[model samples]
Target: MKFFLTKSYKLFWVLIPLVFMYGLFNKEHSLMVNIHATYFVINHLDFAGLIVIFFGLFGLAYWLMDIFNKKLISWMTAYHVFISIFGLLILLVFYDEVENLEIDYAFKQTLILLMLITAGVTVAVQLLFPINLIVSFLRKKKH
Candidate 1:
């Protein structure tokens, strides 16, 4: 339980606002147009809201993992990765709608790039870190 409330869990608290700002100011239509191609409405606030909620859920998962054992942490990490990837994909599909909503193109691009970079880093960390930790633990156990 104590682990669930650690600094790492709190770090995600900051991301909630970032997701909102990114969705609010970033153009989505240009990105979504290529994917949807027709009749997609841009809902900036709604998308931002969803991102916030997802982040909250992830935070809770982290908390639960922290309260449990190493096996639980590994499972939670996998769950977080899965959910985050799915959310990113959904956002990508509708990104062009943000442009249609009158957000500045440059700002939109910057936000998209930031989101992509963050997602990439997260995926990399999630995939490598846990496996490495588990392997290290196993080796230590053997010795």
Candidate 2:
């Protein structure tokens, strides 16, 4: 339980609000987020709200996987990767249909863009630890 409140988890909690603020101030829509103002961001997504949600979810996943395998972090990464891939597949298959929808065009587009970003970030996070280890090992051999 205490482990779940570490810096890494806090950092993720921070991202939800940073995203919301970005959405609010981004007049040009350059940030390109999918969050519905009335449905998602305004109600369910705040700093405290997201922290509780992620903390509970991660803690549950971590402990459940820890029971069978000790590699909780690896499993978490794998889980994120799997979900991100699923999101990408949905986006790819339904993109044309979504784009052609008559109503709420901007909202739909923003949602698709958000899905792309989530997929990208999840992949990057999963890869980063392994990539860093490889880079560090190569550097040590060179020295």
C-alpha lDDT of candidate 1 relative to the true structure = 0.53
**1-143 per-residue lDDT for model 2 (tens digits):** 33432223343444445444533443232212244564222221232343345444544543444343333343445444345334433433344345556778789768667766765775565454455334434552321
Supply candidate 1's per-residue lDDT for 58.
60
Task: Tell me, by TM-score, which candidate is best.
Answer: 1
Supply candidate 1's per-residue lDDT for 28.
Answer: 43
Please give the lDDT score at residue 71 for candidate 2: 37
Per-residue lDDT of model 1, residues 7-117, tens digit only: 334645667777777667753423432234565454656656766886776666555544543233344454445446454645544445444446777988776665556
The TM-scores of all predictions, comma-separated, are 0.42, 0.32
Given candidate 1, what's the lDDT at residue 123? 61
Would you list the C-alpha lDDT of every candidate in the order shown? 0.53, 0.43
